[model samples]
Target: MAHELIYMDNSATSPVDEEVLKEMLPYFNEKFGNASTLYRLGVDAKKALDKARQQVADLINADVDEITFTSGGTESDNMAIKGVALSEIQKATDKNPRNHIITTTIEHPAVLETCKFLEKFGFEVTYLPVDEDGLISLDDLENAIKESTILITIMHSNNEIGTIQPTKEIGEIARKHNVLFHSDAVQSAGKIPVDVKDQNIDILSLSGHKINGPKGIGAIYIKKGVRFEVFMHGGGQEKGLRSGTENMPGIVGLGKAAELARENLETRMQHNKEIRDALIEKVTSQIKDAYVNGSLEKRLPNNVHFRFSGIEGESLILRLDNEGIDGATGSACSTHDLKGSHVLAAIGVKPALSHGSLRLSIGPENSIDDVDYIVASIKKVVDYLRELSPLWDNETDEYIGDRFEKPLEDEDIDRY
Candidate 1:
């Protein structure tokens, strides 16, 4: 085994920052108290919670009262989508009920699955398509809106391809149409600038673990005066939007992470971009049959997703593991399924090539040396995998098209 591990999967999750952990330590022990309680200890806990809330709100340029703490990204997403849906459904009359929601095809499962669940309850949904660069067309979004459209939900940045959508434009369109707009900003919150007020976003979701904070902590920014129904019912915490005893430690960690992110956003972004661009330049130039997966110019600074023909992404990932480098084939949440990534499919990547896609997301911790090492390891792994692939034709030094055309066998799918 290698002596040191090189982690490059920040898109999936990040290690807690030392400062964030330090801030959280006190909450887990001496300051442990229910934020909902009325006693002195509880008052102290409430003060901490409120301060953390202000930190999170400041990071996004949202009012403190508009931020609602939640379990994580998924919970925040579910609450935003379901909360809006539930509220709209309740206010609808049989004669003129608004039951429509518009979203992109490449959304995270939290948004997609919630929309899918709402479909069973007689809600109409429009799943907009993305272009080859994994970006949805503004025209498509504008056309999707209807008189009954209640919400327009889209992600600020893709978790897999790292494409940054035109959220400000989308927000403008939603505002003009009088529709509530929500964005899953989990992937973009700390790494990029997210101003809810300026963007005209009514609701936004973000997670702690995505930004070097502890897991199981996140927040949803619901614009004050927006008509949204409650998600969880108990204790009447979070202004009755999300109700339960708060995870004080995780909240404090998230606050510290947010504060740090705001303070060093420019430096952090520059560091990530330097490493990411270097890796992309080296890998694409040095490796054979390689292609970058998303819009290179309009993508997240920390993300580098690419595809190498005639090799399986999972196989490549495992080989990299042996070299002490960690990465991912796609969204960590969708790894269990053997089918091609939905984001790749939405972007028109061939199913065969989709299986060969790899995502390397760098964080502030990664250095120039780390980027060089990652590129070198990837080149070796891809070449080795291609040499062993049955689809590779040694005679022509090319991939066999017919072999790729073959459908995946059920047994083969199960192995992955």
Candidate 2:
């Protein structure tokens, strides 16, 4: 009972599993050898790196050679976008035109900023819009494609809202048009089943820390036939695409994490969903006028988002921290930005409600007791904050008494 710091922020990151930590310990001391060297230690390190590559590739049904290790998700995205841009210009045959990239306005900064940088070099970018449910319409995506479009980069799942995009449809569109497609699966990889081959992903990005692995390591899966220029160039490592000395320990840790995640995908997914649903159910049942933000049907198994009106999300997160519950107000990267989440605002959430948005993402290691603790803490915090508001006039205390058995008497309950 004492070890009860409830963590509901798996979307931001997760604690490295004890086994994964053990696997990485060797590279820090006894096995500290440059993967590019020719000695025995180096040989062992190189083999470990290669095996790790296969592990990551296996998770996504990609070829081992297709996966290139990067610092993390951001670098993978930058490499995907910038690498394609440079490669296109260098090898543009005929009047194929080196012009534009099509992406959604709701993309993560990794994709958004990369598109902005490519624009500085005379390339055009079209940022498509998303509907109120955080789903980008297929028709809008179709209209955005241009004659000079070189790539389409979108996220597989929204980090804040947990809305899973129609990646398969988008991939099909890209492939039909002969344009490249890249999906940043940093949030979706371990949370859901992702097969790059089945999705027809030209390029994919995933981070290690998201799947109970060590931080500072990620992978980019470039389809075997796809051509992308090198982002990191030096030694002949990574087939000359990435040249730095490999992070053997981090890679080993990543491999172990990936393997474990794949092996337990179904079981972990079911357990996480049960815990997540309990959190969502308990919060809405006990709190007044609280609701889940994003598509309930097409969402991550462990994600539960909420927009608690009349309270600042940053304040709620701080309050939750005091209650020994760790969660988030949107992405960890935007904690200090003070802009109140462009992702939430993009889905047409009001500025006031958007300011109070919180994302509670669960991990496989968490338990029902953890969810119950989080729910209880949230009920107390939200009730306290709502009491302070002069605008709290429509509070309810029925707790869905009879509606639980009936076939949804109240239409608005599902929306909540």
The candidate that achieves the highest TM-score relative to the unseen native structure: 1
lDDT of 2 by residue, 1-416 (tens): 33357788888889999989998999999999888889999998998898899999999889888999988999999999999998888755557666788887677888888888888888888887788778999888888887788889989998888899999999998988888999999999877899888887899999999999989999999998887888787886788887887888889999999988888889989998898788888888887678899888898998888988677788799888889888898988778976556777677665566767788888876888676677788888887766665445436532222232233222211111
Which candidate tops lDDT? 1
Q: Clash totals for all models, in order? A: 0, 0
- Which lDDT tens digits does candidate 1 get at residues 1-416? 47278899999999999999999999988999998889988999999999999999999999999999999999999999999999998888877588999998889999999998999999999988888898899999999998889999999999999999999999999999999999999999999999998888999999999999999999999998999888799989888888888999999999999999999999999999999889889998998788999999999999999998889999999999999999999999999988888788777776788899999998878888877778888988988888898877766778785564755443332211
Model 2 misplaced regions, further than 4 Å: 1-3, 91-96, 390-416
lDDT of 1: 0.90
Instruction: Give the whole-model CA lDDT for all candidates, comma-separated.
Output: 0.90, 0.83
Q: Which residue pairs clash within candidate 1? A: none
- Rate residue 104 of model 2 by lDDT: 77
TM-score of predicted structure 2: 0.92
Q: Give the local distance difference test score of model 2.
A: 0.83
